[model samples]
Target: MLESLTMVRHGESAGNAALAEAITAGAEESGPGLRDSDIPLSDLGRAQAGAVGKWLARQWDSVDAVLCSPYVRALETAEIALRAGRAPAVRVDERLRDREQGLLGGLTELGVQRRYPAEAAARELMGRFYYRPPGGEAWTDVALRLRTLLPELEGHVLVFAHDLVIVMVRYILDDLDESTILKIESNQLANASISRWERDHSGLRLLKYNDVGHLQ
Candidate 1:
């Protein structure tokens, strides 16, 4: 079995909190545009991160390494988790950043749909995984970027990245179709939710997904 690697999403962000409001507003129908990448995490998100770190510490005697996205939310989550668990130093990588929302960035979902119905519909139908932002990347693009970061592989690596990045990575590992990519749960992961994987002769197999037992 390949050494176990733990992948987790950053703690709660303005996006996650706004999610309920966005959905309630029916932004999809009204066309509020999607938000951009700069949003930071909420206090709850930070606490969740600490909880995750505590959980990791209890579960593993030691974590060999840490890799994280350069984004503020992800970086903060990684840092908090490491500090809580006494984890190793974390290495920041742009390859692990969230999916580019493109022209849609900063707009509410309904706002965007109303403003650019065609674009919004296209993005929803085609999904962001394979769809490229006007100047941004497709889901495949993100995966390619992450591929460059993969080493021969190391021990107990903890990765903190965006939700879309997490989903696309699952596609790469599971060999799932881009069309069906969104069908799988976004795996946005609770503030500190964790997923584990192990590589074998065949490939990496997910041992767990969206585990937030630590928060409880």
Candidate 2:
């Protein structure tokens, strides 16, 4: 059985900033132009990663294993945090990637409504948890992938990944329902936020959720 699991969301990326800007300005596309996996972290994102690393150093003596998503932003965050904390080498895991947006990849909510009304309507009917955009994976799909990965991990493990992945981890480990998980997701996880779980007599219990005290 796994002893402890700590998952960290990647620091904010340029794509994250662009998406917010597009939504705020009512633009159609976020306009990062690059593919999702290639987007890098922003300056503040790097600083956040460094802060998380320092906090990690102060919290625990060592993590048995470090795993990270292959996405550039996640990779960069893992690298920075590891260096700062003098942690072990990281292993890249594609299963830890962010939820694929597919046809909705670059579009803001307004863009989706204006450009793909049918899809927007379909999504509304299906709800966020079950809605799978054309060619994209739904929230359940992410949980499926994580299920395959969970049994493989052992001892104290640190994972650096995306927001959806972090939330899905909680959903699966906690046996949460769709509405509960959606409620948790609604509160946007902070850049470089940390969540931890520890194994006890019954099972793994959440110790922290989206803890960003170190960033402040």
Candidate 3:
């Protein structure tokens, strides 16, 4: 079986913009719109999506299918990229959604940390790959879902998800443990950047990781 899999994270959202502004102003305040799902993309995010779509349109004959998280930012990113070509069938899979934040959802980084000191400490100590938000999922759980779904994919496929999802899925596909996975930068896969991998006799091989030059 010939399979080419490409993964991408959703574009920057209003949450991102808010955070950026806060950072620019040197304020540690948290915003109220950083939900775990369906955060709309910002203007820069749209630009990134368009650029990624154009790049992908040139890189492959066509995407066989697009599997996306139901989050608005992810859906928008996938739609923008697919529309650049003949447009592939888009499928919504909850398994691909962002890490659930529970009460931390819709809060800024400071807000989450301040609200859930123990959970925040846990996340910081364990790293994002293994960190589990209170009343939320752990990386192992996300890995299980991805493992169950990945083998079912056929042909060329594109997945649009969140940073943690990408890292966890990559960990499973690459057969790496927490150590190696933890070494990877969380933003290694930029907002519209794409990472490619394919299966071989040995197993899945990493052809590339986090290619965002197209956005430049």
Which ranges in model 3 have alpha carbons more than 4 Å from their true place? 23-35, 60-62, 122-128, 186-188
Q: For residues 1-216, could you state the per-residue lDDT of candidate 2 as single tens digits?
A: 699999999998999999889988889999578999999999989999999888888755648889999999999998888785656779999999999999999999899999999999999999999999999999999999999999999989999999999999999999999999999999988899999999999999999999999999
Instruction: Give the Å shift of residue 193 in candidate 3.
Output: 0.9
lDDT of prediction 2: 0.92
- Backbone clash pairs in model 1 (N, Cα, C under 3 Å; residues 3+ apart or in different chains), count: 19
RMSD of 3: 2.4
Per-model CA lDDT versus the true structure: 0.73, 0.92, 0.78
* Candidate 1 structure quality by residue, lDDT tens digits, 130-152: 56757667777888886776653
Which window of 10 residues has the lowest lDDT sum in candidate 1?
Answer: 28-37
Looking at candidate 2, what is the lDDT of residue 188?
A: 89
Give the distance in Å from residue 149's predicted Cα in candidate 3 to where it truly belongs.
Answer: 1.3
- Top candidate, metric TM-score: 2
Query: Which of the two candidates, 1 or 2, achieves a greater TM-score against the reference?
Result: 2
Give the candidate order by descending lDDT. 2, 3, 1
- List candidate 1 stretches off by more than 4 Å: 26-37, 59-62, 124-127, 186-189, 200-203
